[model samples]
Target: MAASKTKKQVRKSQFKLTSEQEADLRKVFDIFSKGGEESGYGTISAEDIKIAFRALGYEPKQEEIRQLISGVDKDGKGLLDFNDYLAIMTKKMTQKDDVEDLQKAFELLDRDRDGKINSGDLQSVAAELGYFTGTMAEDLQEMIDFADKDGDGVVSEREFLKFLKKTTFE
Candidate 1:
């Protein structure tokens, strides 16, 4: 009788990494993997995970690393395989990029570096963009009103972020 062969199932990740990103991740993983250059499939210890995170520009607390490992380490081994490391790193990198982009936008809108977005800031930005007109005060006030959730007459960083999240996500 002929033996039936079963194919290994490959799980698809929701997040996709580019070739350069994948290469960088592999380099980091191999550097810390238990097998080093030999097996290329070994897991890394918790301490190794912390070092790897730093090498990748993350400064997570030890407790945060432990929690992340616990969440992603599928075999309950308290170690990270390449797949787990990739997932965690991908998520962290994406989150950091999002926050950085948001911060840049907020700084541009803040104009005077006062940590808040008021009508003056809006007017300055509008004028820079050639959108300012003689009657733009009412329009700018409307914009501020839309974003000022706490009725504070201005948008703080937290409020601006909340407004963006609401508009973008919903």
Candidate 2:
């Protein structure tokens, strides 16, 4: 009987990394996955990611960590494997697309991946990012009044992008 062989799947990513970036990422991954087997498929849990980020002097919020993991976890397995780490490093090191960056910010703010942001979403994001102040209702209303340009009670991607651009340019 012949043995059946399965090919390892390689996920396609939007951005590519330079050789130097790849080498640097490999080095970082080694630090995170020291006790793992030598096959290079070492994985890091989401919690471990938060610890690593903190160790590197980043005060990352939970939503930020979730966004980072979900954005790069190609297989959607909830844990970041080696390839997923590489995808994240590539995006971080080569983020030249304004729209892509905006979309990433939108995704982080959306929280629920609903393609829109409402008062609740804004409140949730504010709380997660540790920026909440004043009454929740008041903050939500203020944010909506400022960014809900279409007056639809929710901020669509277009409105979100416009809001960001306006704030950035102002």
Candidate 3:
């Protein structure tokens, strides 16, 4: 009998570090991109960040770029890790309509009158948003089951938010 092989799945995340750590990551990234120049290293300017973001497939507006660089250690002493960059990266900075729709989605997901949303809320919201099938409540439950992290019977707000953040790649 031949054994069946399964490929390991690589999970993609928006960030895994703090805002300050993101700066550090950015410094290392920039230096590597600049041929590892150590002496009189040039700062990663707003323009540079903008161009980099574009390369990363995100074309944020000038104001958004300015905001992202506002507190950067302009001397390149501080760096931006993946996590730090995530806060600014996923934001709907340039498009007002997109922000409004995102807000609406947030509102719908926050079920049970709680300020936060869980996986159940996600199922309902997804259904309302027409992202699923079979109009049955059981169907929604099954979808929620797939995304719920804690077996405690509900997906926490943070988990739902994480699911949203991760689903971007799909």
Candidate 4:
């Protein structure tokens, strides 16, 4: 007997949003799209995402949310999104979490595949985020060092997962 594989049908794009959902999502976008409103980085903050999800009656894991937000990392620069807020939020289902999403985001951030986010990439991402300062490079490098437990000068999957877990939905 021969086996047949079923191809999944793909859905095209649409831009229809209920007025209330649109308003709430937009509010969230504005909050995140702003640079360093709280932290010195323009990157989307955890607080911003929590508010957004709360508006939608949802409480997603922050790391999961970051993976979802990664979809808005459109320029392949490993930076967070600022312009595609509404489109990304509306397309949330495609950004849902899984082990694969975790791996992908990590890979994207780790430009050299040395198992960690390098200071150069981090600084570039932060600058694109409109939040970079000379000292931020040192601070982020320290975070990398703190997170990279093996002293291999790179963050292994285990280390990354530990950090990810800290951001997960309880």
Candidate 5:
């Protein structure tokens, strides 16, 4: 499936938060919502959105913040309610966690720290994980071939992410 289609499907899907998660998110929202005298009791401004994301361990770019606010601020009043905040946080947290996990996996495979995973990296990682059978060279090469979209004989970070997303979500 196309990345755009996957994104749309993700948006259409309902993301649930546990009661504990909801309470924690609410606490963060409330703290930011009451930051200034002009702040409302249950709404947060765009700046508050940035701070809230940071508090939640995400360092979103300014453009990302603007896009999120534009997408979720239904009234265009430059403020977000708890429901809007929850939606943004839920989606963002999910995406962040997936990307972070993928990144960590990629880093583990890229043992040489060369920013790309060659067959040697894959072989080393497989050996470390005790998965190195005698046919390891061919297996590692096949893995690299599957993920190396550019046919460069290695998997770059972008290719690794795209490959995993395609395989996992499709």
Candidate 6:
């Protein structure tokens, strides 16, 4: 029987923290926030994110830091409350189904909706993802060359699907 298009698909459960982990995360959140939640003044700013990244031994660029902050700063208020922090942590912690994740990633990267991803396409996506740099053109070129199985100078949807399947296995 053919599947019913009207049926809503169910996703896997999202990540949840243990009580001890939640406590630890709360402590970290408090440290990053301006004040306690009860005071209605607690929020982790972009600077807080940068400091936390440094503390975790990562030296991200300003754009990357902003992008990371945007993912969790729900209100776009340039800050993240505890709930926002929890949401970001949940997204980062979850291990989703590979095919589904790849599809979503591909759609995000294929901004032009032309059913293919070229060097220009990758460059735009990298810029939005906060990875643009002096060497970004070369990086995108290398990625295209590596993934373009048909040697068409671009990655077609078929090629992308194949690459995703192989990468998932690896």
lDDT of all predictions: 0.80, 0.69, 0.53, 0.62, 0.83, 0.69
lDDT of 6 by residue, 1-170 (tens): 33432221222242457798667667767778886667745888767876755543445678866666687776777877777766655443342344557777788888899888888888887788898886879978999899999998988877887896676433
For each candidate in turn, the TM-score is 0.66, 0.41, 0.34, 0.38, 0.65, 0.42
Model 2 per-residue lDDT tens digits across residues 14-59? 3466688577667766668634648887887666776665543446
**Residue 45 local lDDT, model 1:** 80
Q: Which regions in candidate 1 have their CA more than 4 angstroms from the true location?
A: 1-15, 62-67, 126-170
Which scores better on lDDT, 1 or 3? 1
Give lDDT tens digits, candidate 1, residues 1-170: 12332211111233468999899989989988886458677877877888898898889888887777778987787777788888778867765665677778999999889999999999998899999997999989999999998998999999988788566533
Could you tell me which 10 consecutive residues in candidate 4 have the lowest summed lDDT? Answer: 3-12
User: How big is the positional error of residue 65 in model 5, measured in Å on the Cα after superposition?
Assistant: 1.3
Error in Å for residue 117 of model 1: 2.1
For TM-score, the strongest prediction is 1
Model 4 per-residue lDDT tens digits across residues 53-126: 66666667778777766766666454454445565566553333334467787787776667667677677778
> 2 or 5: which has the higher TM-score?
5
How does model 3 fare in lDDT?
0.53
Q: When superposed on Cα atoms, how far off is each prediction in RMSD?
A: 8.9, 15.1, 12.8, 19.4, 5.3, 14.3
For model 5, the local distance difference test gives: 0.83
Model 5 residue 31 lDDT? 86
Better of 1 and 4 by lDDT: 1
lDDT of 5 by residue, 95-155 (tens): 7867888899999888999999999997787788898887889988998998888999999
Candidate 3 residues 3-76, lDDT tens each? Answer: 33221122212224466745654654464344324552433434466666665556677886666655553555
State candidate 6's TM-score. Answer: 0.42
